[model samples]
Target: MTVQFTPDRLAHRDDPEVSKITAISLSGTNTERVMHIVVDLLDELGPQTPAELEHVYRSRAAVNDWPVVAFYSVHKRVSQMKKHIGIVAGTGVREGGAERVQLTTDPLKAHGKITAHMQGGDE
Candidate 1:
């Protein structure tokens, strides 16, 4: 579905000095963890370009001492989340030529979505 949103909305939220999430408290690889982070970010802050997702995610990940570098780049992870998990869908309108994405209200359970994302072979 297409959506038109103000780029101004991207700056609507400020980064917190310390992330509410305690990295020492969570389990999973950096890839798994950041996936959770991006999903929650979109779910909370709404549709955002991949660049916007990186800005907030890296900042928050830093505060938690969670290494942001991983097997998949942040941009790729965002695309994977949508292409594989189905938790977030593209808004269909680029925020000034860059792709923008938002969360999907998939009735499928989280585990179900994840299972699909983890499947072998190309989709």
Candidate 2:
């Protein structure tokens, strides 16, 4: 699918901090794990600004297996998440210079009930 984002959205996402967090979430060369975390993140926050979402995810207890460096490059992680898990994401410009990222997939389907159950209600 064609990824869409406004110029303003791209500019905000290009922020170094955002990119860094994405990187950490996508590390470990494990697509399933990366997809799991991204979906879990969405489940918890619904939708959120990149910074807020990143902070919550990086600090979560469930992410113990997530790679540390993955938190350093959110941009790259986003790309990988989409490529592997069929998650389409969009960026929106919010008030006060914030950027939001939300999943384009339906949450129930995105979570893969089997795995989500294994993760203990993370979905």
- RMSD per model, one decimal: 13.5, 9.8
Across 1-123, the per-residue lDDT of candidate 2 in tens digits comes to 232323222223455765544433442334345456767787767766655656765676354766454543444445544544456465664734665667777766776742443233444
Worst 10 residues of 2 by lDDT: 2-11
lDDT by residue (7-83, candidate 1, tens digit) is 22111133231211332222335445566667677767888998888887777776777655532256656765776
TM-score of 1: 0.60
RMSD value for candidate 1: 13.5
Q: For each candidate, what is the lDDT?
A: 0.57, 0.52
TM-score quality measure for candidate 2: 0.49
Predicted structure with the largest TM-score when compared to the true one: 1
Model 1, position 3, has a per-residue lDDT of 27
Off by over 4 Å in 1: 1-28, 70-72, 106-112, 115-123
